[model samples]
Target: MTSKTTTRGEPAGPSMTYSAIQQPAAMSDAGNVLMNWREWKTLFDCYIIAAGKEKASSREKCALFLHVIGKAGREIFEELDLDDKAKTDYDELVLRFTMHCDPARNVNFERHLFFEIYQGAENLILTQMIRGIKGSYMRERLLAISKLELDDAVSWCRAEEGP
Candidate 1:
């Protein structure tokens, strides 16, 4: 008999483990895919903060992230329900990570994390990441983030490096 699967195409099991989530399995060299998953979600949350969209505000971003986390089988959202500090820490981390990339001022972090994650997925998946970020107010930063190469991201972020 065949097992039922999720509409998004996930298996009916308790969600894939981080190890199973890697597309190429070879890309597993980046260390703890689950951590990267959490980071990507956090980074997306920060982008919403930068966008300042009234309909899709930071609170809504957090809610969206909770949905993402739930689908990923991560219990973090439930933990945050009782732990105010966890929620604060997640918010603060998102704020600190993207502080320099503020649309009102400068760009930092360069969104390398998403690029790295994208490089591991299919080309179509990377396209989705780019399109997902296009909703951001910082269009330039979003474009830069969309184009960043995983290997060159470090050098790309160095401010003192001469052009």
Candidate 2:
């Protein structure tokens, strides 16, 4: 079943906002919170909703996104004008930022390369496992074998063995 929502039409969950994430204090507390890529991602969605810009036009959403980020994120992006031709979907903006800033974006593939048990020296993907050890060259070679190529080879062998 679907969950309930607030009278404001937001979820029953509390909405995230600049003030919520960045608490105000005395006048001396004058600095924007420079959110990391992860925090910005999480708050970005919520900010869009809370501001009632979830269904707003792409141009509006783009402007709101940039505004939600405010001064702290100005440095992260050099050029973002809502009137620009490239100003399209808000998701596109999110993608561009992720590509530029997400540090752990390739961590999973790197982890898999280091940790997957070598199937065999004859293994099509990990084709150079030498004697009971895996050298850097072998690991490098294994990384070179894209998952699509391995999948195609597996499919070919399976087809040859027939149903």
Candidate 3:
């Protein structure tokens, strides 16, 4: 018997169809660049996967990414310090955009701020203890230990008070 196939809406044969992938919205807010980039990048990634372009060549993927990012994104891409080879690399392009979107944090300054807050809390505890102590001698002792280690100050208070 001869093989037969039926088509629901079209002739029975191998066929392929592609729907237009929606472009992600262009980033607009300067203050929210990092947040906007993160959102836009997510949408673009979904677009790539939905369009069956995950296996596309690096150059082609890079081109598609650049195209979908809109005018401002293109400008930012142009400003990125990419070498010739990197220009054709999708991962390199993504890295450059990520760096551009998210600025490097000042680790030293952050550490200093953290220590300042921690020291402030310790000083507050010492000040509160000095105010609440019954004797002037105890208050003086607490004040002296304020400039020393917090653990030392606590141990001094505990030792002077007894069990």
The per-prediction CA RMSD against the true structure, in angstroms, equals: 20.5, 13.9, 8.9
Q: Model 3, 38-127: lDDT tens per residue?
A: 999999888888788999999999999988888889999889968999999999999999999998989989866776787687765665
Clashing pairs in 3: none
List runs of model 2 lying over 4 Å from the truth.
Answer: 1-35, 79-83, 103-163
Off by over 4 Å in 1: 1-35, 42-55, 80-163
lDDT for each residue of candidate 2 in 2-59, tens digit (9 for 90 to 100): 9877666666755523334432121111343223665666767766665566789887
Worst 10 residues of 3 by lDDT: 8-17
Positional deviation of residue 150's Cα in model 3 after best superposition, in angstroms = 9.5
Clashing pairs in 2: none
Q: In TM-score terms, which candidate is top?
A: 3
Model 2's alpha-carbon lDDT is: 0.54
Model 3 segments more than 4 A misplaced? 1-18, 111-163
TM-score of 3: 0.60
Of 1 and 3, which scores higher on lDDT?
Answer: 3
Error of 3 at 115 (Å): 7.3
List TM-scores for all candidates, in order. Answer: 0.24, 0.41, 0.60
| Candidate 1 residue-wise lDDT, 14-133, digit = tens | 654223222111111156545555466555545444444325645554555454444332343332233454454546534432332233522344455655665565554545544654
Number of colliding residue pairs in each model = 0, 0, 0
